[model samples]
Target: MAFAVTSSTAIRSSLSTPLEQPKAAQVGAFQPSDRHHLPPAAVNFSRRRCAVKPLNAEPKRNDSIVPSAATFFASEVVEKIDVEDYGKLAKDLGNASPLEIMDKALEKFGNDIAIAFSGAEDVALIEYASLTGRPFRVFSLDTGRLNPETYRFFDEVEKHYKIRIEYMFPDASEVQDLVRNKGLFSFYEDGHQECCRVRKVRPLRRALKGLRAWITGQRKDQSPGTRSEVPVVQVDPVFEGLDGGIGSLVKWNPVANVKGTDVWSFLRAMNVPVNWLHAKGYISIGCEPCTRAVLPGQHEREGRWWWEDAKAKECGLHKGNIKEQNSNGGVHANATVQEADLFNTNCVVNLSRPGIENLLKLKSRNEPWLVVLYAPWCRFCQGMEQSYVEVAEKLTGSGVKIAKFRADGEEKPFAQQELQLGSFPTILFFPKNSSRPVKLSI
Candidate 1:
C-alpha cells in the first residue's frame, strides 16, 4: 500500500533517520557506521490488554469518537485509545465490510484524519470514503522518482474526484547529501532503506504527526510476510500522531481482510482509475528504480525490492507489521527448537537482566563483547543464527564474547527502556573500554 509524505523542511525536523554502511570489525571491536534515532520519549501504553479483541465476542465500544461528524475531531470521549474500550475497536469491526469500516473511521475522526492515497487499493479507499458522503482528506508522498504513468494517474485521480491531493516532497538537503556521498543508485548495491527513509518514511512521519488517525490501502494479499496480520483498525504500533507517541496514532486499514481479486472487482464496479503500471504486470508499485513487474501467478510483493531477501521486503512505513514470528506459527511457537538450537551455543553467552546490568557496570573490559537482543520467534533472527554462531566460533580465542539477551515476552519493556530495543535481532557492540555500545546495521 501507499504512504504519506511531507514538505522538506517539516520532514527534516521530524524525521529520525537510521544509517546503513559497511562494518570494519576487530576482535572485541567494531568501527560502527550505523546510526539510529530513538523516539523522543516513551509513550506508556496503559491497559496491557490485547489491541484486538475476539472476533466472535461482540466488542463493547463506547463512541470513542464524537457522535456527530465535525470540521475537525473535537472528541466526545477525549480518553486515550489504548485504554480498555477502544482497544477492542478493531475486532468489533473485524468482520465488517470495507465500506462499513471506512464510514466508521471517517465518522469518528472527521477532518482530523486523512487518507494516505496512492495505488489501486488506496484509490478504492477514497471511493469508499466518498460513498460515505463525508468530508475526508487525502495526502501522498512524491519521491521525485515515481513512474511517469503514476504521475498522470495522480492528476487523473484529483480531476476525477474533484479534490486537491496534498503532496509531500522529500527534504532537499537530505537527498542532496545522499546523492553526493552514495550516488543515485547506491540502494542497488547496499540496500533500499537509506534512500527510502529520505523519500517515503520520514515524510510520512511528519504527515502523521498532525493527525489523530490515518487510513491505508494495505491488504494481506498485497504482500506475503509483512501485511499478513494487518487489522482493519488498531492503535498504531509505530508512528505517533498529534496527541503524541504510541497509541496516539490510530491506523485504519479498511481493506485489511480484502483480497486482490475482490479489490479489482470493487474498483471495476465503481469505475475507479488505476495506474498504467498495473497493466504492465506491476502489481505492487513503489519508487520507480526499486519496483518491477512480476510474472503471472507471482506474488505482488515480488515486484518491490526484488533484489533483497524475502524477509526484507517491507519498507519502514509498516515496520510494525514485521511481526517477530516465523512462518511456522505464533510467538514462542518454536520454544523447544530454540532451547536446543537457536542461540544455545558454547561460545555465546545468554544474559539475563541482572547479568547484563553487571556487565554494563564495568568501566573497562578485558575484551569487547557483541550482544544481540533478540526474540526467538523472529524469522530474521532465526535466519542469522548460523552466521552468528560462525562468528562466535571464529572469535573464541580472540577474547571476544558473543552474547544474546532474550527480549521477548514480558521482558520487552525492560529491553526497550534500558537496551534501546525496538525490534527483534538488535545487534549492539559493547566496546572494550566503555559500557556504551554502538548498534550495527546488518
Candidate 2:
C-alpha cells in the first residue's frame, strides 16, 4: 500500500482545500508544521522531552541476547527456541494488541530480532519496541532508488528514536550487471519483479542472515489480495535461518491484524518520525521511480506498480507463497523453457524486421491484431511467454491474429517509433479501422 499516515477521511476532506505551504527547512529536517493534521499525541510528544538516549551513550548488552549462527559462529552459544513454541505463542497472542505482540516477540528474540522498518506502520513498531525498554535491531533496505526525502526521514527517525538503523544495500556486482545489461530504467520497460529481486529481495535476504527473528509492519488490510492471510508470526518458508537449524528464522508481523487507522493513531500518539513523502500523499513508499502519491479515494496499492495488474502487484519479497498463474490455466513458480518454446511455436507468430512493417501495413487494410513486443533478456517477458501463447491459442480460430515481436532485436527501431515502447514486454492492440494501437494493461 502507499505509505502515508493521514486517514482517508482527512485526506479526502483536505483535497478540496489548498495545502498549507511547508516552511523552508534543511533537507531531511523535520518541520513542526508537518504535524498540523495529526492527532494530539503527536503534538504532545513533539513538545516534550522524549526518554531516548543519544547513540554514543552505549547501553550494556543484555546477557539473554542470542546471536544467529553467522554472527556467533558457535552452535552452543545460544539455546534454540522451538518453532512449535513460537506457534503456541502466536496462538496465545492471536487476540493481543500490537504492542503486546511486540513485547512478547522482543522477549523471545531479544537482540536477535530486527524490525523491518520501511513505512509508517514500521515506525509504530519501533515505538512499541522502544516502550518495552528492550534491546532490539532495526534495518531498512536502501535500494539506491529511494527518494531524497526518504534519506532525510531516515536521519529523522534515528535522531528521534536514538537508534542506529542498519541500511542494507544490494550487492554491487549484481547491480552493476543488471544496469549494464538493461540500463537504469529497465523496470519501466519491463515489470518491477526482476528489479525488486535485485534491489530489495536479495538485500533483505542478506540482512536476515544473521538474525533469528525479524519484525515487519505488515497488516491484513494493506493489500487484501496479497497480504490478507498474513499471520502474526510464522516460520518463514521462503527464507532459511542462520544455520539451517530448527527455529533459526522466525518472522513476526506484530500489527498483522491492526487496521491502518490504528497504526496512524499509534504513530501520532508516540510522535514517531515518519517520511515527509507521507505528507505529500505517498502511502506505501518504496523506490522513487515506482512510488507516487495516490488520489484521495484510490486504494493504497494503486500507488505502487501502477502499470501492472493487481495480481502482479507484489515485488517477490512477500510473494514466496503466491502461485504463479500460467497462461495454460496451470499454476507453478516457473515454466520450463521447453514448454514456453512449444507454446510459442504452436500459437504465437514470431515477427522479424520485415514482419513488423508488414503488420503495420495491415493497419491500412483495417485488420486488427494483438502483438507482444518483448526483449529476450527480460525475465518478465520470459515468464509471460507461455501465458501469451495460451492467450493466442484461445483466439486462434476467433478471426484475430496473435503475434510476438522481439523489441530488443529486429523490431527495435519500429518499437521505438511506432510502438513507443517504454518498458520491456509491451503489449498493444491494433483495432480494425484504426491507425493507432492502444497499449493493453497486463
Q: How accurate is candidate 1 locally (lDDT)?
A: 0.66
Query: What are the lDDT figures for the candidates, one per model?
Result: 0.66, 0.61
Writing each residue's lDDT as its tens digit, candidate 2 over 152-182 gives: 7776666565555667788788689779978
Error of 1 at 331 (Å): 4.8
For model 1, residues 1-442, the per-residue Cα lDDT tens digits are: 1112222321221011222222311111011112223333333322211121112222232212111111211122222332324547788988999999998887666555788886445789888877776566678888998888788787777656655566777778879977998899999987787788678876777777766788999887776445667788876766766666455667889999999899889987876677778878888788889989999988888888999877677666776654544347753321222223255556799898898887778888777778889876565565455456656755667667789988887889988887878787788777788767767665
Return model 1's CA RMSD, one decimal. 16.1
Residue-level error in angstroms, candidate 1, position 315: 0.6
Give me the runs in candidate 1 sitting further than 4 Å from their true place.
1-84, 327-442
TM-score of each prediction: 0.62, 0.58
